[model samples]
Target: MKYTDTELEKTLNELGKATYAGEVDVVDKVMNRLKEAENKEKFSIQKERKVRWTIGTMSLAAASVALLLFIGNSSSSQAQNENDGMAKFISEIYNRQSQADVVYYTPDYIDILLGIEGMDENI
Candidate 1:
């Protein structure tokens, strides 16, 4: 309902001044909530730092392991590739139809055979 300012003031005066109904520590409650929020924020920040450190450490370890595996496998594969190239070259040279007879044993091969037979030691 609409009322003039003077009528409103007269009504309020008849109602008397308002009084608080109960004991309420609003300031303490607000301060306690602030403290709890700050503590929660600090805890979350520390947890975030821990998670970052853990992820960083794990990533470094994974990279290190990958590097070691690559280096190790590369050296072994290089040796294998060299051996394969030499074998392919020898097969091409010695096992051809035009050069089958030229694939006969050499003196070094005969010596190795004699040593395997225990005859080179006697000689």
Candidate 2:
């Protein structure tokens, strides 16, 4: 629905002259209600912020704990590797023995050598 400029001006003038015959305190009541709604909206926003902060704090703490656990596990594994000198020595000896056996020993001689070395004791 399109209106000419004159029709639009006349409609606006009529609307401007309209009157309300309702309660005298209606404006004040509506203003009070609007103020109350604004206050509730502000409170809800504050509550949401508090909840977000709490979740963020919890997430940070969990991440910290996970990092600490990972570091502790890595440190322990490193320490174990550092203390494995005997195991490394035994591995080297076994590798050398195998190479020597391939070049010099029969199966029977290798069994004798294993008995003499007390392989169980090394383990």
Q: Judged by lDDT against the true structure, how good is candidate 1?
A: 0.79
Q: What tens-digit string does per-residue lDDT give for candidate 2 at 1-102?
A: 899999999999999999998857678889999999999999999999999999999999999999999999999999988779657865766777787756
Residue 87, candidate 2: alpha-carbon lDDT: 74
Model 1 Cα lDDT, one tens digit per residue, 1-123:
899999999989877877779987789889999999999999999999999999999999999999999999999999999999878866654445345454466545444533555566678
| Each prediction's RMSD to truth | 8.5, 9.3
- Decoy 2 TM-score against native: 0.52
Q: Best candidate per TM-score, number?
A: 1
| Poorest stretch of ten by lDDT in candidate 1 | 94-103
Worst 10 residues of 2 by lDDT: 105-114
TM-score of each: 0.58, 0.52
> What lDDT is reached at residue 4 by model 2?
98
